[model samples]
Target: MTESQFFTPHDLPARWRRKRAFTFVDTTFSAFLALWQRWHDDENRCDRLHVVALAHLPALDTPPPADDPSPLAAELARAWPMRVPGTQRLEFDAGRVVLTLAIGDDIETLLSRLWLRADAFHLDLTATADPRKLCKTLARFAGDDATVCAFTADKQQLERALQASGFACTPRDAYTDAPVTARFAPRWRVRRHEPPLPCEANAREAIVIGAGLAGCAVSSRLAGRGWRVTLIDRHALPARDASGNPAGVFHPIVWRDDSVAARLTRAGFLYALRRWHALESAHHDLQRTGAGLLQIADTSDDAKALAHAIARFAYPPAYVQPMTRDEASRMAGVDVERGGWFFPLGGAISPAAVCAAQLADASANITPRMNTDVTRIAHDGRVWRAFDASGAEIASAPVLVLASAHDAARLAGLHGEPTRSVRGQLSVLDPCALDALRLPVIGEGYAVPLGQDGVLIGATYDIDDADGEIRADGHRENIERVAGMLPALANTSPGIRAGRVAFRCVTSDRMPMIGQFADENAARLNARELSGAWPLDLPRMPGLYGAFAFGSRGLVWATLAAELIASQIEGEPWPVERELAESVDPARFLLRLLRHGEFCAA
Candidate 1:
């Protein structure tokens, strides 16, 4: 029995009103968004729609006059936030609908990296993106029988290109802003680039090596996705490494031009807040000083500059703002010498409690193997096995993720790529000495007040320092840095012989590695075929991944990175953009070398 499915590109209400889940691509978003607002069914059940809108997104560039009459104009004024040149995902109707806005110059280049397949398409073609080239690009992601509706002034030019590009076209009357309907089914065959296929695993079981914040986070995200995660660690419990800090602060960095570090951290900070709230709703116990952490500037001039950025970027007052000396001193409950920025949403949190909470929430799906040192790893064609010092198998699974800080590259056999360890130590100050302090204040060093646990300070960032033993000089340096910000701290000296020392895993570029581990051997062999390769183009070690080199940003980065990894494993839409994803890709170094022809001579 052969039955043909009828498809048309009408207004959202008339075209896709009943669609439970649909993937759509559009150039300008106004028409589709209008359709979605009227046609979406939220009262019955959770609806699902994936929309990729390619546009300059004029509203983000500059707002319309406040007195504009149109709803779109009003929205452009009221809802506009940060919009740099990249992919932006906005959730609506409780995440039942997601709009992935691609705001850049090249539509083909941006669309090429998306891992989604389109079920329908809408376009507004201009002479710059001629109808012919645009149609060809749209065909790359369209389903076998995808339907398209396009808007353009030159109706003849648009319809001709759609017909040539394998669409059975018929001019429809005012069905949409566009007057043409094109159904995809080509007369001639053409080779088109397909997005990366999701990785297939032999089993649902996986072994995560490490019990630090990163490992615990990875385990929880995977477990929530129905994976049986076996968590192995060399230590007895989670957060006993660098994550063992008595208390840590989490906030986004601010740069004058909103550099990559600033933009990426801003996203990370927001996502982490939502993730933490979810974990809390699941009954995870988290200990913190509410919110509002103050960061003193390194110098008086830098404080003024940062204050200018906060206003220039129009950051929400709930996130961060500038503070005068008296204002900051009032927040800290102590007399601070210099003015700085105050993070209203930032505060000190117990790292151990977070790690424990994640593990407990996922207890049913997570199996913890404590003190099981994983010294050697091997893959037996299908499953990966971890061995101890005695060469006895301790854990086995179809997938493996290395989140063991500096040990990750070593375990994954990626040592020559230049990841190293830096030793840091945090000192616990006496409560009486910090009695006047109210909130966590950070400058060269941070001072976190834990109330009954006394105050936490220090954290000297000594590079290439491997000795884990706490030193007297380290304590002195911590006290000195803190004292520089709060003049009253000059009288106190508590870190002489008391502090905890831990090694931090750092990368050459400072961004954490979060993705599938690329197979260097395969890349070297396929060099000619991959002369111009992107991160997704690199050959990957099947079912193996890493979330390492987080350095001091573990508090802010761990949750988001874990979510990114989980999205990859579960074949879900990514939480971050393509360019940002590439920035943190594990094989970026290898791709850079290939791009530079560094391996061609050998």
Candidate 2:
């Protein structure tokens, strides 16, 4: 049977889409022995063979009553090697030969799921006489190593199969039943067994699924708290999504009396500034431009409302000052018919630079697993397993956190997650057009800046659209918006334009979703009625957590969001208020559903 037959298209996972090979073949003890001998001869072989003794063979333990290998295989199948370090050794052939234990339960499944053309095949122990599993395993392992044979008494048959498969093979006979071993280490190894399992009273190793700004920040903070963490990302590099933007603005949008969004944004903004300052040495070309965001008042009503809101907050003019249309034009270096509010301390930061710095400075407690994508999440009674598409458990930890934008929803554990992907476009103008504009990070409909090389102008917000493709029409529309905002500079450069597009993950309420996935939903459901009877509100999957729904407010949430998540993992008081901390809870959708009859009704 083909690998496609093993899994339905819809049931297939993303990790499988990225697997290395997909072929299958049948094997017997004779084939296994012959292939093992070949790998032993080829010292430069890159493909390492792993053999997990399905069950201890008769000699090692007491022999079973039945000679049927199927029953024995079933018993051996019951015991799975959860996660083996990348450097384990198994002694076989009575210590005369040594084999590294590299293969496991899902080896065949995962191998077939890969998308690679060839895998350096070595003799593996996962095959059976059954042609179906054999074919599946062989197909998956049909890489550079596909030509290799396993230790088998039927050397003649093995030679024929190799030739048919276009492999040049030489087989050898074994003198004794020396328990041929194939215990090798994993490619991405971490010390196992030393730390207690989730079974350990206090789990030390935690797993984080996404390596975005939020996930990386959380991992760093948790590592600082002395917890060992594995930060995994589907992308080969960190901060490749919204965090990949060249530059991003940061500021707290304060409303009267400090609304939930305002208060949290304020806290998140300040925390981020402080965090960046602490990490400055590691980050390059970082500067506080001093230019604040100016919210343009479109009408008399908007102007009055801005003034009243500023006064209600009682903030110093430095943080929330009002400027007339004339002052706004001069400060912005552009003409504006309306007045606006300016935030002096507000500014922008190069996002990728910060993320790179954080990853570089990450502690020993944090191990970054790049290019590993997680497609399925399974809770096997004790520990939560993050598996790739091939159904191979890649990483297992007491705690699992999902920080990838909307990708968190892909996990069955987070299938009901409340996050939305939004499309946004930003533009850049030529040097001449930029020279006519100021270098401050301005806001309100459209903002302009003189970046390091040229003037940066933007942006178009489309909440319902999630396409990352750069749209010429969107860029043209944004240019028009900018022209209207500063009519005096309309003809500065008629055809000047260059732009980029990206997607933002948002929630219905506009606030970030940060906190234990379990409790947030419980609280949301009980907030109206079952308040007292809510479960411990802990995460459904003990170590599984998430940080998402950041929307366009990534800068505002990355810092405090990380702090809040790290605090929860450490069992400490949340950096922000309880209400604000739970405001962006991952399980808010679940709570909303319980409170409102329908989930999306909110």
Candidate 3:
């Protein structure tokens, strides 16, 4: 059956239309595309329409034909996702419409992993092996009054499955082949935790601490959703910490197996590219390179293995291609010793420019409070208030986000000191140095062409080292590392000692904390009862969130981190998968402590 026959525009309820955001789930691609087209064409649609499409097959290699008559199809085809496992969120209609493609081989497994309050469901009976299991999973995400419409030949089986899963199935009017419809009017509790709902805010205002990429990105996302943000920073301007670096490389990590970190990085890298494109479309100069970035393998054998893995995974050349030694040399414009995978879209970007552009995008809704250090934060059950070193209240809002890097844990009163400071020293080469370096290359170290600023290279990772000085030896270290990748740099010297030193915040697990903070006090009070509690089971501080500890991947992780935090605040469909989001949850450290019986309650 066609998608139009299973569901149509008339099926959308008035209540969902009035909401700030509504989520729609579809098991088939054609139906998802139809829903996307309907929402895109509707002039009086809700503030945001989130369409989650579950696919058991890989994404199409080619997009829709340019001559396709449907504008929606053409636009969606342009943003078609890569053939990667995990969720890929594509935004259209200037961010009003979001399509989350959940790609995997198992439909039930994919549905179970997703976390969203779906307002509507379009199921494909032929796609699922077991309709009962699929319906049970669907009940977990269904919102109040949620509606479901499906076309099935075995109507009795579908109706029984829907009824058993708590949906009140509507009887067909004497038609055996007609589509079945149902509403989420469950008689008993179907889920342990209630499905997500819009955050109850007294006002649409928030206080964002720090002004780096994390803070700026959060403020911009929240402001875009019509929130008034008071942006506070210790520096006189944004991106003055580690984000103050001249340039940073952006790319996704490809491992032999798709690890959690790899998936999270892929999501961040892709989302950052989309956001950067949007910013550039608005005339924002991100100082981004389009020539792509080259990563060198440790050895020739490892390079061959990675290339084999790339082919085995069938990664698109547009995303990443295995590069031969000669090809790597041609791309870098210099002779290289090793060959590795090349990210066609990966390159260097100015973090400060990105932060500036994000802040500029939300300028109308942001009130910048520069040179104000938030030493403490307090929540009074309703609003969160920030204070300065002088004990003066700096800003207060219904919602507060701590994006202050190393200072975030302290400000939020998190127990365990979940983050540590790492001092990194970067060296900037003269324009004449590394003249043959045409694009960014990373391995032991990284080198990027900064136009008139010359080649940007080197980042000495010194853990637990607080000494923030640009030393001559640090420049030597950077030169030697990059020289290993590009043999031409062997003759280069630390002639000018031109570099900058900044501190980076990182967790022991090397993952950034991105979501809402768990209420440590409350959790400790019931430590025994909560020891086995999941992330969602942990009590969260009202109106308080965090987006910090992004060590070196701030350029890539910051924007997606911001979107995740913003989605948490607005209760919108998450930009990443549920498991991926939990990996970066700020409460992860605290949850670990609780689980291990290591946390001591006060």
Clashing pairs for model 1 are none
Q: Candidate 2, residues 52-151: lDDT per residue as tens digits?
A: 2221122223322245354323332332221211112232332222222222234444333222222223343434333234333344334333333354
Clashing pairs in 3: none
Candidate ranking (lDDT, best to worst):
3, 1, 2
* Greater-TM-score candidate between 1 and 2: 1
Please estimate how well model 3 matches the true structure, expressed as its whole-model Cα lDDT: 0.86
TM of each candidate vs. truth: 0.82, 0.61, 0.96
Against the reference, the lDDT scores of all candidates come to: 0.75, 0.56, 0.86
Off by over 4 Å in 2: 1-201, 281-288, 415-417, 448-452, 464-466, 489-497, 519-540, 597-602
Best by lDDT: 3
Q: Write the per-residue lDDT of candidate 1 for residues 483-545, one digit (tens) a residue.
A: 899888788655332589988998889998998899888788888777788776788888899
TM value for model 2: 0.61
